[model samples]
Target: MRNLQGRLELCSINTATLGHREPLNQTIERIARAGFGGIAPWRREVEGGDVPRLARQIKALGLSVTGYCRSTYLPAATSAEFSANVEANRAALRDAAVLGAQCFVLVVGGLVPGSRDLEGARSQVVDGISMLLETARECGVPLALEPLHPMYAAKRAVVNTIAQALSICETVDPDRSGFIGIAVDVYHCWWDPELTASIATTGQANRILAYHVCDWLHETNDMLLDRGMMGDGVIDLPAVRSCVERAGYNGLVEVEIFSAQNWWQREPDEVLAICAERLQTVC
Candidate 1:
């Protein structure tokens, strides 16, 4: 595994870690001054400011767009809703292109509203991705499908495993043209029994697009907002990083935490400093 002792250049922070309490422009400046190499800003954060100016500012500050946070959920109750969601994704992809992002992340949403058929929802996900590949390919932005934890299987994401995300890729980008891939997040995937082998397989296919770090707390109060920092929870983060590196993913290792009660309630700079410190020492 690679030693990241002083390599802040290899680290990135998903702006959501700052709790979205501030505008992205200021957030960008603080993150750059904090010595991170990249920032993954969410769509809402980007929309609050001018993309053209934001793009210029980020470039001037010398930060890579690790990724555009996500695609709108692909599954919906009706054909029209699904089509609208696709158009929204196309627009998001265009914005991602404007930022020169490394990839456009996809959360491949859960079962459609008012439905319980998991297989049907997965179909919508595959078809939605197939349709969006045109825009993604045109923009030259790879789509990084992110599988949420199984608990999110009903409301956030139906694709709950790396294997499932890879299966979607097989159906959509069979040629491996680099247009489709998976975004691995420890919070969502640490429970998978086949993660190490899946990471190896993802490397063999060159489909691992992003690696996210956050710990899963054992006694979580809220599943969506209770993620822990590195070394604060039960996850074996260093071991996971080794597997990811061995699988050939040498890109930025992003920190994405959603701690509503703890970190989010603290000062942003302190969070960023802790993130940098943890990435270097623990992660």
Candidate 2:
């Protein structure tokens, strides 16, 4: 079965690519019609207007949830800011449970402005995740710590490497617990010298919770939102896929793009069509 392309359960779409145009219900229908196995939606989409209603819509469309977009942004300068972030995560976690999402992706917070203490931010992240892991486990939702690229180390996430994410998980959960894991996205880790080894280690520990796919533009125009389409960029996606598969991660390969200028301007159906084509050819 090595030549069988593994399984067709590999295709998923992140709803953000279509956020500029489609409603959540319409997007789900479109994605489902495109033969995708699952979709990962952002909290903004989930809370756009209604949540329970949207959850029902997702189930009716017969689409699986790869994972929730995010829940953690724990590094804050003040107690009030920290508490607010915690509350947001609690709400997001509940939403994940309601939608039967596979995991609640966590972008552990980065350095606050004017603060250079990387270690401090990471400690806060660990604390926040530790505090929420219990509630996550109780709700039957997994928390997938997403290690963002170093480019975002100062503003989005301090956990910038797979090794760092796994270390935090190991420390917070210690016993290689089931609910806390990592979300590996190609765009974030393609340049990592330790990616392959980290994937192997994560797999052996059974901490590979979610897998996201996207191409990283060589001439990255925008640091935050300019993600390229699969084959349009330079990432060796299939090679990454090989690593993930070898590591025993057979979960959906969710496609997450934040192309503010490219994809977000296309028709939702057109985006889905392209995604379908790319899923076969590029991803």
Candidate 3:
């Protein structure tokens, strides 16, 4: 296992950790100054900007973009909507490629509103991903499918487990072409009894594309906005990292927290400082 102790070079900051409180340019500067090795920016921050120029800026600052924020929702209520969503995802893929991102993260969406067809939604997700695979390959941008927590199954993502995510990859890219894989976030997956085993499976298949870190608050206030810092919550973060490293995942450790009531309210620099400190000691 890699020793992350006192190694800030292994740390990557997902821009959301600063709560989107700062502009993309400032966020890049602060993150670089904070001595992190990489940064992952969201779609909101990338759209309407000069993408190539921004990519140059990030490269100039010596920070690698670990992954692009996300793709458009895959499961839609109508055929037209699904087609449009797929087009949008293609656009995201192009942007990710232009930005020199390691991969384009896919938050494969949940059921259509007021719909009870869970199986249908899952099928749409699979088909949607299949449609995008060729484009992903053409652009040379890998796809990282992120399975959200089961609590988000109704609204955020139907892909709610690492095993489920890997299954999609296996079905779509049976050869393990490395164009499709999974992004494991601790906040959404820490409760799983099979997490360690799943990580091993993912590693063996060479499908672990990204690894995210954040703690699950025991007394959570809101499902979407109450994430805790690395050591401030209930997750055994170091142990989780051990499982990932032992499974052969030698990638950046991305810190992606969405604490609207807490971390977002603080100064961005302070947040970056705290992330560096926590990553070295506790993660």
- Write down the lDDT of every candidate, Cα atoms only: 0.92, 0.85, 0.92
Tens-digit per-residue lDDT, 1-283, candidate 3: 6777777778899999998876799899999998999999999999999999899999999998999998888888899999999999999999999999999999988889999999999999999999999999999999999999999999989999999999999999999888999898999899999999999999999998899998998898999999999999999999999998888889999999999999999988888889988898888
TM-score of each: 0.98, 0.95, 0.99
* 1 against 2, candidate with superior lDDT: 1
State which candidate, 2 or 3, has the greater TM-score.
3
Judge candidate 2 against the unseen true structure and give its global Cα lDDT, from 0 to 1: 0.85
lDDT string, candidate 1, 1-283, tens digits: 8888899989999999999999899999999999999999999988646898999999999999999998899898889999999999999999999998999999988887789899999999999999999889999999999988899999989999999889889888889989999999999999899999988998889999999998888888898999999878899999999999999999999999999999999999999999999999889
Off by more than 4 A, model 3: none
- Candidate 2 regions with alpha-carbon error over 4 angstroms: 1-9
Query: Cα-based RMSD of the predictions, in order?
Result: 0.8, 1.8, 0.8
Worst 10 residues of 3 by lDDT: 1-10
